[model samples]
Target chain A: MKKLILLSLIILSVFCSCSIKTPEEYYKEKEKGKYTATISINCETAVKYKNSKRKKSEILNNYKVSYNKGDTVFTALKNACKANKIQFEYTGAGDSVYIEGIDYLYEFDCGKHSGWEYSVNGVFPSVGCNAYKLKNGDVIKWLYTCDLGKDIGAVK
Target chain B: MFKNFNPIALFIYFVYVLFISVFSFNPIILTAGILGAVFYCLFTLEKKSVFKLFGFCAFMFLIITLTNPLFSHNGRTVLFFINDNRVTFEALVYGAVLGLAVIEVLIWFKCFSTIFDSERIIFLFGKISPKTALVLSMTLRFIPNFVSNFKSINTTQRLIGSDSRIKRYLNSFSAVITQSLENSVITSDSMKSRGYGLKGRTFYSRFRFSTRDIVFIIISTVLFALSIIGRTDFVFYPSIDAPSLSGFSIIGCFSFSALSLIPFIYELKEGIRWKYSISKI
Candidate 1:
């Protein structure tokens, strides 16, 4: 009984440690079935900087993805990037994961105020991407803004 | 050579080198600073101490360079995945640059400590704030004194046949702490008796602003200005930005290298002059 209790505790801790599941694992488990979403990554505002390393404005246009009920915009974006083989990088984890860069363009690359920002259904959520949960048929757009969302028309 | 220069000149030289080492991330600038510092250390410090310093710096550099990729996962050109996190070439480069910057700054500081001894420190700050200068000098002097004091205490304990290792160390540490506290009180009392912070106090110093010092100061200031004006911007995240060798950046690197080597150059000139004078005699 003591051995069984220790094993259960270890299993519980393992689950707790990895509470933030990858999209593939979430799809495999399908705890609340699945819902479809679309995500696009663009560096439209980077055009203002002539010397920027932006390959193209449209990185991934209207890319479709699937996620579970509790999945966030970040999860959908991650799934889309993985499927399309597009490079993605972020810092922190869970609800605090900041999308640092996509396609080699990082924060402060173009200018001081330049960085990656995300919007859901045409509304820019002030919170981090991982913190903003996604609904079914949601449209997620990851934009590289050179002016802190002002030039991207994301400010409201 | 260092002693002949005015305290202000030596102070300015050290400050400029430290500022450049700490602020600039350009590869050329960093490499130049490291080479200059290592060369200066070779000239000034004993071989054994230099080797020890280099060995410790290398260990620290490797630890920082390796551990950075494990934590920072933001970069292109993924090498592999450790626990599903991408370790990239850019992060590795960034970490190595960071490690070099830290080591370079530390070496420059070591050089500073060798030249800017307690007497020079007192001379520099004594006029403006005598109390602060006294405290700073005393604090700086206390560290090595504490080490020697502990060693003597430990030896005395050993002579009296205290054989347990843990007990010996613990006893010596406690004794050192108490002794330091007592010494601080005595030192303060002595200073008070001497009227140390009294106004209208006159200080005697051998340093003077000579023609050679004026020339040295001008050269260092010009080099420092050139380095600041021509410093290159570098990016090492998401993707490693290749260090551009633009004309301005090359100028910056050259001037910075020259600035860092001033001390070594001075020492060499002095050594050559001494040899020539001996031969002539």
Candidate 2:
């Protein structure tokens, strides 16, 4: 009985050591908000892919996020993701920031014509996400399209 | 095992395994590759040294897997976040696979060096280009020779009660480099005097293709073709999914395992046969 108890304790300690540690909070809540914007991310078209990572059509609903002046749509998305713990990945830098993947769905994942695109106030800008500066109370919606923005109602 | 097969057969086997290990990202293939490399290394190299090599490879594998997600955040299943960057499970798996492929190739090269000595190298490459063969053989020979020479020089200096440890290494390294340069000049001169690289030059090699070699080559070629045809299409970004195991892929996996284990199986069979013959005697 004593040996059994000792063995169980050792095994319990091993399990404890091997178990993954809960990751600490990464982003701190901002103290002040100079401006606020509304953002939403959806991958409705990803339903076509059988093995997609999307759990639902809407990955992130309209979340209100605060940002400073000169913040781009990309910055707003990044901050919102950080605050909400949503996984977001992007390539390029500054005004050229291109959202490569979000919530595990990446570009060209569904098909060659599939990718992530965003529109501000129902207007899809010609420039990249980081280049499009966010205005106060701006409405930004990110959509995943299977046909290169054609399915998401974004022109060329 | 080396004595049982012709140099060409061994060369082709190495190429087949190396090609598969490099191109395939599937976990099944990589695991098979690691197992085969470990077993083959055990057969060729000292058991102690094999363990040490594998220990180092395992350490490197762990380091790559853990550190890969820190720089790239392109996976769906978020394990946790590090400084606002998402450490996804996908990137970690990708890194692990990448590391495995790297160490697999490295161990196979270790097997390559053990199997292909200077004689086999020349025998394999001599028919195409004699000059290149000579250069290749000489260079391959020089690396081990240089290390041994450095060790002897370092030991002599140690006996002489030389300077600091670092100083001894630098001195030995310099001495080895100079000696290698002089040795290369002499080798080139000796080859020139021997009329090497001349047209219609006949080379001597003991390696002869036997029926055994033909059988081994055919088996290896067939396995190689199967592996290529049934290769895995694993996607690592945005999310991780189970490897789609089609009929061809399952066959490919089996063929790959067989291909990698060929050397070990041959060695084991030969060992058992020798034991049986001795028991009869």
Candidate 3:
């Protein structure tokens, strides 16, 4: 009883938000492997395409990028967007990066079910973009589906 | 427990803890305040009361966590979506932390209410403004008295075979209203009969300050000051870039921890002493 308060106090203070090194520092402290991935925005089948005259080659394509082993899909896609000049809009969630739009094509812009969806190795990741860390030879696709990812063959 | 101390010490201690709970948004400092409150609750309150508080806090925590992600879709990570809006883990975690901080502060107030009863509150405020103190004390007394009266009336009705809960509640409510009206009339009559506010009116106080009280006041005030001075600036949203602890923050954390745990420590020491003395028999 005498030391109960004292012990708990010490534990609480230390466990408190005193410090969690930045992701950069964390990776620097540990050995990291080199990895490469491919990311591209697919919007050829968006509902807007039926009425617009924009060509498929101008809107959809592939991007090859390299990232550190622990780099998330969000980071890789972000870097690829920077390199390729693709417009991207996102919001931050604690661990998940919330993707709202790509190339000015936002969710619900094409239709009620149209939005951005990401798939790794042709499978839609159940987790958020930032939550899915990149791996060697990973294939990431940004699919824009006007029919709830049905147009991009990504929803199922 | 708080009443045993000089009202000065009690007031200073509670104010400091409450301030820290409100201003210190960091998860760790907030957690310490919460742990301090939890310890206070565990030591002073019944198990049922503590559990009830915990259940309420947990429910609040869930609501905050689930709802924050819906409105503020800020974060690099998107967990899921409702319609076109993305729900992020960052917002969820942020809400949970904020919710925990609020719950901890509320529990601290609960502990405050348990320790600083009306008499102590009146004593604390009485010297500054007599009328204010009287009103404050009476307000505190009226609520509990009204509740207890209602309960008793309901029990009597139940004993007389009124089984409908709704009817009993309504009956009790009306009975208390009538009782309050009668009480106000009698109270005014008694006050008028005694010439309460007449010239040469002077009030008597039972409180006596001791050397221990002086020492306690000085210590608590100084420690609370240190805790305030040591508090660091923090921001939570957009990203978590919490600065590492410096000397001042460390001092604040230690002092805050020490200040909040005072009651618990005092009670524990007294319990040990009493047990030891009893064992001699």
Candidate 4:
């Protein structure tokens, strides 16, 4: 009986030592905020492939994005596309973003006329195209050819 | 009687062992846990098999340590250099630590498997249709049989000149799947023919909860609670910035490890009693 009591005490002590704080409590301690936005993608270079000679029409519609504090730029872009109801495909090697079957070839290109710039922690890169870490309020833009001109929507 | 060899206690201890091994940073705690597992296996398992397992774990540990530095490059302290590449002291230590953790986890899992043998499966989940239970039991039983069967199938395939790497892989995979499906069908037929779940099925277990079980359960539960509480607010990292010895911390870590050994001690006591009774007879 005495042995049993001692063993019970040990078990209780170990259990109490390892208890984890709830996720809500952790976030409250960290003080994070959430953001939502829309990301648009247009494919301009797609040619007629199947039983048609006319140029393929490109569209970038229905992008929805949401992210919390400390989310990376890639994650933010993904969340934004999901929130805006836009269909997008990721090129697996982390180069180029595609929307509605239209590939945005210039987003990853660093040459002049690429019309894309990347910044990390408010500092622009000197050379080479690399992933830029994102901060709050940082904006990412992609310019693609569209026949219908630009469309804009707000995210809450 | 095997005093205090309760399945519930063994399950709780197994969980606690895994928890401590993953969380505890102190090398002493980790080493003690590894040694305790080895000792427990020695006390319970056949000697030759346990020795073979120990040798395999040692070989695996060496291979992991040698290969881990190729991928993970973290840690500040560089111990040596191979050409332009640096072999950090941290990588070797980390690999050994991970290897030990894996072996310890496997040992704890083995204990759980032994404690909750087929009989306990029937007792706890007997209400689950006999068809389902029988399928699960057969699946568990078929793993070893499948491995041996695959080896024989591969040898025959090699003899038949169908031994290209791709062909071997495809043939072996298809063979195992076909055999497993056949085994499952046979098991189901046998179970149904025996009227497995006609009306209700009865189960027999060699386990019962005595006073010892109650005491063991209470103690293990309490220890689990305490370990969780101790870990929650405590910041061990960043403080572990260096590998300096602190005697008090060492003692504290070992004490926790020793706490995990309660079930093993209980089993040892049971073994001793059984031996004594047999001798007297």
Candidate 5:
């Protein structure tokens, strides 16, 4: 019981830090359930004009994955990409993960504003995708926002 | 008599120096902070403690600097590739700067902790809030008291010559905890009889603001302002360039040096004054 309290305190401290966004911070309160999320890479419009040689099917256009406890949206995306044999490139090992590319279409490939962004249930989470904890029935859409996330309707 | 200076002035001066040391990452500025701290420690700290501080700081510096380039692959001029990640020249230099900053902050804090005693802390906090002052003073005293109590208990148990060293240590520790609790009860009862935490309580302050204190405070405050102006335009990634002494940065550099050296300067001044006065006599 004492060890459990200590562990929870450590978890709380990790979550409280504002260095980068974590998904658990996106929710109003902690919720427990099995979750399903969908991920897609949308570098098609950007890649089509820029590089015609790269195949559109090379990108993970659509994939669905279920999340367990302590699972994040980034993990879901990672699992989906791995299972489907789609190339997914990300940097950072922990909660501060940055998704840099999907398939052959990497960041700065299309334009200066092009990068990966994620939305859960139509609302973009304020925290990083890696930090966002998944809840039951969470719907995730991973898109390539070409105009600093403005094209994808992300607020931050 | 506290090196013939007011506690408030001394506290404020240390605060300014610590603030600058914590924030500034320029190598030259960090070097100055380290030098000032070393000078002060050489004069003030025991010989053993001074050596220990230097050794510990150097060890930490090397560890922090060496590991940084391995993990962070930032900078343009790659020195060599270790496991495909380029160990850039800029990253190594950046790591050194960070390591130096850490060392500077630690040594400066050591000086601050040694100089400012519980009396000074209580006097500083006692002015505005008496309850907080009492708590602060008690917390400060508790550590030393606990240490001394533990030592005495350990010695007493060892003298009895009963059990093994580990068992004796465990017994002493348990005794120390119980004794400390008992001591607190006795202490509170005595304080109650003496009317601690009562209305209209008067405090005896030994610290007096002299002309030197006023001048010192003013100068330190000015130095702090100047140091901020001399901010280094420093970035550690993609490429590395030494922060050139821009006109504004020069002011900051000078101010930071002066602020950091205040304690050393005071001691030097006092030494000179003593020698000159004796010569006159």
Candidate 6:
């Protein structure tokens, strides 16, 4: 009888040792956020007709953009142009942005092509005058001539 | 101590141990069941037989653990090297744990077998059918008798002109099989001649539902019901991750099991007293 009691006590102790917490204790920790806006792209028709030299607006006609965001001027310019549905083809030499299908250019070198150019937040410098961050109102122009290539489709 | 050890109680405890070990993954509950079985075995069985059984279990445990890792490679902790093979500590531990559980379950089963011999069967289940009861009793008796008979026949055949061991073994096997068939036929004929299953069979049992038996049955029934309900309804799957044991549950299990042995304890005590009075004469 004593042995039985002792055995029971031991078993009880073993079970009691496993301390399990309730589920309510786990619900107190998590994170919060919100949804943002979408960006699009546009192209000219001259670049579309296999015409290398034509009016920038004639070649690149349709508009499309890819959404992006970063912490620099080039990133901002890229984002604004992306938001405005303008496509960029390669611009000449140093630092410049081009209208993808349209064969129009925006150069930061002041001597060649020109347009409204400003530093994003007047902070971090731009890479090829293309790295820029988006403010409330920033219209980025992409004017260059080449093929806008394929739209490569949209992402959802 | 002997007076307290009841066959019915022992059987109940045996069942409880078996149930917990198999159904409950809580190591503590399993350990308790194992310990209870070991304690019961030590208290009841002869020392030499217990030692022999323990040694056999140890041998089985070693064999199982050594062979288990070759088949199952799981768990995260590595123990040592064997021929450039890293044996995980978890697999080895699991094998040993399983082996111990098997041994503990067997010990409890043996306890039940000892307590519920032919007489107890006749007492408890006699009313079911005389033929069924007789067949069960005879089967239990025949197992050991058949083995001994087979051994003796083999020896005798070898002593006579048998040529090779294989031939002698085959001869002995055939003889035993033929003899067993003849015995069964004769037994069946005798049973039929005696009107073994004619009409309603009346049963004779020394067992009566005393106050003790009634109490024991009630407690056992409740425990069995609770155990079934707990397992089917309350228990969760992947029990390895589930917490299954608690102080109250363990106590409830142990108490129910102990209650079951009351009838057996009464019988043991009665036996002791009868022996004592007979010795006085």
Report how closely model 5 matches the true complex, as a DockQ value.
0.04
* Residue B91, model 1: Cα distance from true site in angstroms: 2.0
Which sections of candidate 2 miss by over 4 Å? A1-32, A38-64, A69-73, A83-85, A91-99, A107-156
Model 2 lDDT, residue B183, Cα: 96
Across B156-207, the per-residue lDDT of candidate 1 in tens digits comes to 9999999898999999999999999999999889988988778988788877
Better of 2 and 3 by DockQ: 2
lDDT (tens digit, per residue) of candidate 6 on A57-112 = 42222222223343333444343433333322334333464222211232221222
Instruction: Give the residue spans of candidate 3 off by over 4 A.
Output: A1-156, B162-168, B188-200
DockQ of 2: 0.25
Q: Residue by residue across B142-211, what tens digits does model 3's lDDT show?
A: 8888988988998899999997889888988998999988986787578658765556666565667888
Stretch of 10 with least lDDT, candidate 6 chain A:
A147-156
Best-fitting candidate, scored by TM-score? 1
* Candidate 4 lDDT over residue span A80-118, tens digit each: 433332322333334233221213232323222223232
TM-score of 6: 0.50
Better DockQ candidate (2, 6)? 2
C-alpha lDDT (0 to 100) for residue B15 of candidate 6: 67
Per-residue lDDT, model 2, residue B278, is: 100
Please give the range of 10 consecutive residues that has the lowest summed lDDT in model 3 chain B.
B77-86
- Taken in order, the candidates have interface RMSDs of 6.6, 5.5, 12.4, 20.5, 14.1, 24.0
Best-performing candidate as measured by DockQ:
2
TM-score of chain B of 2: 0.95
lDDT of the candidates, in the order given: 0.83, 0.85, 0.74, 0.55, 0.75, 0.51
Worst 10 residues of 2 chain B by lDDT: B76-85
Question: How high is the DockQ of candidate 3?
Answer: 0.02
TM-score for each model: 0.82, 0.79, 0.61, 0.54, 0.65, 0.50
* Per-residue error (Å), model 5, residue B88: 3.5
For candidate 1 chain B, which ten residues in a row score worst on lDDT?
Answer: B76-85
Q: Which residue segments of model 6 deviate by more than 4 Å?
A: A1-156, B1-17, B46-48, B80-86, B129-131, B157-163, B218-246, B249-281
True contacts kept of 5: 0.00
lDDT by residue (B202-232, candidate 5, tens digit) is 7677888989899989988998998887788
